[model samples]
Target: MGFSSRTFLVAPDDTLWRLSTSKFDRMLRDPASHSLPTFARQRARMASVVVELVASEPMRVMRTTYSVLAFDAEGRLDPSRFEEQQFALVESVVAPVIASSAEENNQPVVDATARFIAQGGRWTPSPALARAIDEAALEQRPCGRL
Candidate 1:
């Protein structure tokens, strides 16, 4: 498999970690290996996770951050899903696509970010979601984009 071009908006909290490890464990057991379906599932899962974080705001921030960071280390996202998909992964599946035989954890995130931005810059968080986070922050909850 090759790298997929995608970007995601994940919530920042513990739920993100839960989603990542769960999916990573599942992928490790997937005998199908590197196929489109596996990648698609991971991608969908990542989207689900991010959307959830986006919906919850401050309460889920830390988990969302960890999830994004972890996935940022290993999974590829499905860019088009940013504004379309609902119910994303509890965390995220961010990482690079690997061939069946490749084990190197050296994919450059800078390159990936560059590519994502080149494709369409960063995703603007939904205005409503941003507003909610701001309100939560004022209440000392402090939810920000992850």
Candidate 2:
């Protein structure tokens, strides 16, 4: 039996080292937090015999399933349900077509940022990305090719 087993924990002590009635009475007088209903209610409540909840905070209940995320019957998320089908379609079809066209004609510069993204790296844009605040303001004119 495991050490956690309440039955296996409490032994008759094969010797005469039984729990003192005076000490047991003192322990009962002290404010005790309820742990084991059976052992607490019983006349003889020992440390090893009864399970004591030694925690300041309530512990989370043991989960039936190992994974934190819940899955459907098919065990996968449907892209359509999440409205991600458009993105998937663009990635599979439109993105490849545009990339091929750019590679053949434009031969676009594969800079560090582009290279990082191509290798599956991701980043969130922030106000720091804009240097317009630091740069001199352009004179107002009709928008045309430089």
Candidate 3:
């Protein structure tokens, strides 16, 4: 089990914007002019998507989805097996990541509920991961099945 983390720029409205480690470091050193899309939660629509985050991503997705739950080989919900090949999605609930400005690419990315991609090996939870799970559910990004 291992822990992975990425830096993000949080918006005033509590939206998390992706930030690269290198970029974050550079931003700390130099405040350059940059612009990001304004996330209008009210305007963003929801769509259901299958998230399958594996240690090795077979394809690239323009949008990212996060899932917090995983099922074991026996189809049992195992909190510890999220990092394994345990993956599934609820078709009824729609993920809350689709928006007007989110059409940058046509690729697919599966953060596997945003929780399954914790590590390449066994899945383990950290304080940050725990919080991320909660946020994923609230946003309906890819977990909790609504």
Candidate 4:
């Protein structure tokens, strides 16, 4: 089995513009930038910038998708194992992003993203994850509030 994921972080407002002009996205779109060494270095730099931005801003939105494949010892498709892996991915990968966004954004944006992995595979986030995000958002009160 193999796992893969990608994450996009952007401000809620002007999402389209931000994504279009983002350095990472621009690099991806440009064919000339596809050299292995150059791409690797640029990717590292972009990731560093994202980390810094997320750490500093609460309102930035993070969009992410992950995929995994699983099979039993007999080579039978294992939906149960795949689902378990999906939940594990959410807990380990998505939870930290939610926590960061809530700490900075001051509100929870409950937009459900449908995740499809390989053929005939689908994963939806758990309700508990949503609730935790909401709670985190609520913890950030107004400046003057008690």
Candidate 1 C-alpha lDDT tens digits along 48-145:
22222343432332222211221222343433333222223211123334321144554434334324432332233455644443334333433323
Ranking by TM-score: 3, 1, 4, 2
Tens digit of lDDT per residue, candidate 3, span 59-101? 2222333333332333233334332422323311223354222
lDDT of 2 by residue, 1-146 (tens): 11111111111231111233343333334324212222222222112122222343222221110001111333332223222423333354455566778888977734333333222312222343111111101112111110
* Model 4 lDDT per residue over 39-132, tens place: 2221110111111123344443243332333333332334354466556546555756876788797876454332222222333334654333
Question: Which pairs clash inside model 2?
Answer: none
Best of the candidates, TM-score: 3
Q: Estimate each model's TM-score.
A: 0.22, 0.18, 0.25, 0.21
Worst lDDT 10-window in candidate 3: 40-49
Worst 10 residues of 4 by lDDT: 43-52
- At residue 101, candidate 2 shows an lDDT of 82
Query: In candidate 4, how many Å is residue 87 off?
Result: 1.8
Note the Cα lDDT for every prediction shown: 0.31, 0.26, 0.34, 0.32
TM-score of structure candidate 4? 0.21
Off by over 4 Å in 4: 1-66, 101-146
Order the candidates by lDDT, highest first. 3, 4, 1, 2
